[model samples]
Target chain A: MLKPDLLIVGAGPAGMSAAVVAARAGLSVMVVDEQPTPGGQIWRGIEANAGTARGRALGAPYLSGLATVRAFRESGAVYWPSTRVWQIEPTLRTYVTGPDGTLMIQPSAILIATGAQERPAPFRGWTLPGVMTVGAAQILLKAPGTVPAAPVWIAGCGPLALLYAHQLVRLGGAVAGFLDTRMPAPLAGAARLAAGAVLRSGRELAKGAYWYADLHRRAGRYVRGVVDLQALGTDRVEGVRYRTADGRVEEVETSLLLIHEGVVPELHTARSLGCQTRWHAGQAAYVPVLNEWGESSVPGILVAGDAAGIGGAEAAIQRGRLAALRILSRLGRLPAGQEGAEAACRKALARALAPRAFLDRIFMPRENVFLPDDDTIVCRCEELRVRDLRGALSCSVGANQLKAFTRAGMGPCQGRQCAYTVASLIANVEARPMGDVEPFRVRPPLKPVRLCDVASLAEEAAPP
Target chain B: MFRLLEQGRSGEDAVTIDLDGQPVRARAGETVASVLMREAEAWCRATPVSQARRAPYCMMGVCFDCLMLVEGEGLLRACQTYVRDGMKIRRQIGARHVVPSC
Candidate 1:
């Protein structure tokens, strides 16, 4: 068994930033990530794409990750890429499986920076091939530098979807159409949010405006206030059907359909550790309850980045640095009166998150889209439909109870794909606040591992 | 369903991996999901529960929609697994068979 003074899960912007700080502070840091490379989803393949034309096309924000990744490599922190931490015991004994099978890690403190994932939304024919999230499409462009051969239709709303459509247009790729699903907010409320956005995040708002204009100019067709969206196909996605603002249904033929509402913090690792979480209504996801230092309710466990909330990469980096400072102070490695540095990080984090409320207000997912049609498959892994879940909800009151009654959240994904939808269904039926509806209890062996891998871990534990 | 961009396809070595009974070329750093998506028929596996054809939805490791079988391993996530030369890949048709460790 190997021991590190600080164990950081994920190698994203947050985790990487924290590792650099903690390791520089003389702590033995081990950063583990499931991806094959260092950059997480936001900066996937950043190292390879840094100086290339593709990176330039991705803009300055993406290339900024190269310096962070380079510093992390030279930080004296041990990074174990492709290592999946399936279990983190109550004793903070972490179990991971990688090239050498399973290994146990004992660490003094654990930081979870697992980051955010695209919110999984279910609709008619979503299970069909060729339908994927806008985030997935971005990964393809970033990693393999691939783009769809034919014109692809993009549906849904948010800065990400707009940004991706703009990126594809910049790449000289074809866009069949864009279906914007953002619901209209009240004029007074929207004006208040827009004023704040203009004042606090003018540059970010300018970038978003540029993307919107570019996509609108380039897209073959653009429709706003779209609802009742569904992929129409047999075996694979053949076309898209959506209801426009005027309640008129429109259909467009396309081989590919990319959808996105927004992202939610990935909570499997943190949840399994029994960290306290509360539902964020605007983001429509459960985020861990963390203190100012990024430490969770469970002492010694810290959460940073989007895992704590929907703060983007910039906020995540500052939060990571703040967490590292706190951990160093706890370890007695830092002298007192470091309040200046701490205050700086806090101010930067606040500035980075200033426009979040405005963005959330504008891009909040449509209420109708949250609850799928009865026939739609909500649980992708279990092939369970909304009707199936509704039948179970008659007897079940919460997510865990519904899982037992319908087996919706027991699949390989462990409810990552269906938890949001399942919780929504239960709340709608039980007539309770979404916060009151409990999510599935995340257990160890979070990712599926082979029996042989478990046996190898046991062998490693045995005395020689 | 996908093609590589000329500007971004910089100095990367290409390797051939066996898909079913046929050989397919893939870039050195590309994952199995990326390689598979290049095919016109991009479906990677059939769902174990419904035998419904499925393709990789999330290129990241979260969604298990891209589960495929390698030469010796049980089902592995295609999006997470990098493509290696001569690696025997097969679409998981149904439930994975129980592999005895004894």
Candidate 2:
């Protein structure tokens, strides 16, 4: 059996940061990812050089990481993209593919930097072809230099939504309005936890207000604030019904609907290893529970990045470096010249962990906004209606109980395509908070592999 | 599902448009997207969902973010066609309110 000094799952900021530190410290490191590229969703810098004007405007912070990513690549750490880690056992797990083909290995340490996902906005016709996520829109702009040429309207809340609007303007696209989804400052108190993090609430809020002003000037007379996005178009999105705060309705017929709530860390792989978990009130999702040192309950396995919780790219990278430092310390390599490195890493990690107050308030998923109307398709996969979720609620069923009964998440994408939608439906129908609802339990084969390859596993077991 | 549609040969003459009354250069066979991209138009479309303003997604016919209004109608994909001379091309904001006539 082959064993390395470290095995990292995911190639985002966190995973790459950890690998760089550990490898530089003379530890063998290997990174495996399911996509063709390394930068996670937030930073999908396509290599074609078909850069957009907005991408150029978003500037260095979004673009600078690639330099670090390039350094990680040249450092000789193994890079395995487009390879899915089907099963991860306590010590060693065999997979049908590596950078080129399937291999098995044991590692002294495992760092998971699996990152975040944008929350779903399940309003009427949101699933239609014209609708997409804010992050997804940025992706379309970056990868293909494409943005809707028609006057596009932006909705939802969060710093990202506005960022997209500004980027659209920078790209020469006209915008209609910025629907502020910020919960009226009264419903709930900011979690004290958000205040205690690395960044100050004042700074984050200031940044958001700055962008809104910039957008206001750039999109003169067009930027309207609304509370609800009623149905958009008839079939594929010809227009949208936006409800103003005064209870008046304005309808704009546009072909696209770019929406998002906020990002939630994808925790499937971390959970597959049985990392201890805790529910994040802000994200409204469960995250792999890890200690200050980034160690999971299982020895040799560590969690970092948004997978630990959405701390942003800077925090994710520092946390990744911290995990490597912890691993090196355990190997009796610390307490010397490494002290300088250790302090630097921890402080960098500190900066990365933004103050939670504003972020917490910014992220907490709304229980009411975009609530699925009756007849709106809740589960995009099975075309399950909101009525179906309501039916389950009448029988006193919840997300977990209903999953086994309805096979909502049994499709090949393995809940990636359906779980959140289902969870939200149940939450809406039952009049409960998302935190109160149980999330889908993630199993192995994080990516779907051919069944034949999965069945031939016995012949591919580890070497004696 | 993703078929690449390449642009054909350039037309013989420069077709023009009064973009908000300023003469803009376009081509006979070029899409509003191709013309705008070759010159000024970059942000093509936005969605009705989150309002994360976006350009037309999937330059192929898949995502309909490239739609623009042609003579009061708002269902044309900018990336999928040619522009005619003197055509009124306005950036699509949303649908105009239609009232029922007595």
Candidate 3:
């Protein structure tokens, strides 16, 4: 087996950008991504979809990924797609399963840019066939150029949902309605944030305005300040019911229900690697703690992109470059006194994240969004409901104990979909902070692996 | 059930797969869940305990609701697995049992 100087875990903006910089600096870099292509979720399938008319119709911001992906491809970095990293040992060794079989790589340094995932928001009938997260719907449109069935009802708050609705409408898909759960309270310091955003990145503000206007133009029934939202269906989603700000209950008949409540850093791999984490109130999730250069508490390992915090794609790219620069300096490839360059990258990252505070304030998920109804399924894997979790919580105080009492996070996902909800529910019941409630322990084979693959691992090992 | 936006716009090669001994039209790069969504009956399987019909919810691999039997691969995620010609897929009825080989 071959060991590389640095191993980049994701192919998103952060990981690819880091690879480009590190490989250009004459360092041996290996980039591994689960997807067959380099683009991670945000830029997924950019290599295959770019320059196509359908891709262009996805809008300008999405097309910007073309240049970064192309640069990574041309950087001479070793690229391995269709590879899943099942485990990363504390000793900086990564175990991955590829087309052939399981392989191990011991890199001198590791960069985990695993990025973000849609925050799980459970509701009545959410497990029904037609209900999916807004991110999932966007993936269908971005990758396969497919749209959900018409009479689609989009619910929840955040920029992603609005952007998806706008893209769907632009792609000639009709949305039946939208349910905005953002509270009616005016965001404080909005003028200041707007000024900062415009001064820093005018193009981003303009793009957001365009998407908003496009969605607004095609809007059918826009319900704001909605509460008690539920997807009503026996077999599949037949309709959605919600209460308006005026306390009026309304129901919209729709075949598809797309829900979003923002995204949080995907922390399973990081937590499994024993990296330090802290609860971020602004993002309403636990984020891996990292230094200015994206280095985690675990030495020789770095965390960047939305994995560190929700700073969007541009900030992720800048953070990736910053981490690469630090790595280059540590490897003695770059000059020692590069404070000026580092400062510039920091400034760019700040500008990129300028609009985040304002956006987070307005789009902060309401309290009810996290606390599911008694009947709502909290754990998608185990089919555990809020009432079930509450029953377990009466006797259990920690997440691990509750997991034992009522198989909440022990399913195929390994707590990916239910960890936050379980922890939040535990916190609510115990009257403790979310941070105090321990997250579920992550085991090897982060994703489910076939037993045959495990048994064939010895035969697939490469000659030393 | 959901359908593609249009024919050529999907930019995917066409392929056919067998779903429970029936032919289903699907694109080469499309997932099994995509094909199931386009069908009249969108559901892929029923839950083991309650026998409740379930379809692909997250579309991504996380939700685990889109499990199906693909070519004797036992239960696999329909959303993650891409379609191929002559692929034999069956609806996952309940709990999956891995039969041991001698």
Question: Which has the greatest DockQ?
Answer: 1
- For all predictions in the order shown, the interface RMSD in Å is 1.6, 12.3, 2.1
Q: Which stretches of candidate 2 lie over 4 Å from their true place?
A: A46-55, A90-99, A187-207, A220-225, A331-335, A369-371, A424-436, A455-459, A462-464, B1-102
- Please state the CAPRI-style docking class of candidate 1: medium
Instruction: Encode model 1's per-residue lDDT on A150-230: one tens digit a residue.
Output: 888999999899888887877868888999898887779878988987898899989988999988999889898897888
Best-to-worst lDDT order? 1, 3, 2
For each candidate, the alpha-carbon lDDT, in order, equals 0.88, 0.64, 0.84
What share of the reference contacts survives in each candidate? 0.83, 0.00, 0.67
lDDT of model 1 at position A262: 92
Model 2 lDDT vs. the true structure?
A: 0.64
Residue A50 CA displacement from its true place in model 1, Å: 1.1
Displacement of residue A384 (Cα, Å) in model 2 is: 1.3
Give the CAPRI rating of model 2.
incorrect
TM-score of chain B of each: 0.88, 0.65, 0.88
Residue A10 lDDT, candidate 2, scale 0-100: 81
Worst 10 residues of 2 chain A by lDDT: A46-55
| Backbone clashes in model 1, listed as residue pairs | none
Q: Estimate how well candidate 1 is docked, as a DockQ score.
A: 0.74
**Per-residue lDDT of B1-102 in model 3, one digit per residue for the tens?**
665776853445558899999998787777888788778788998887577788887776777789998885668788878888889899988777767521
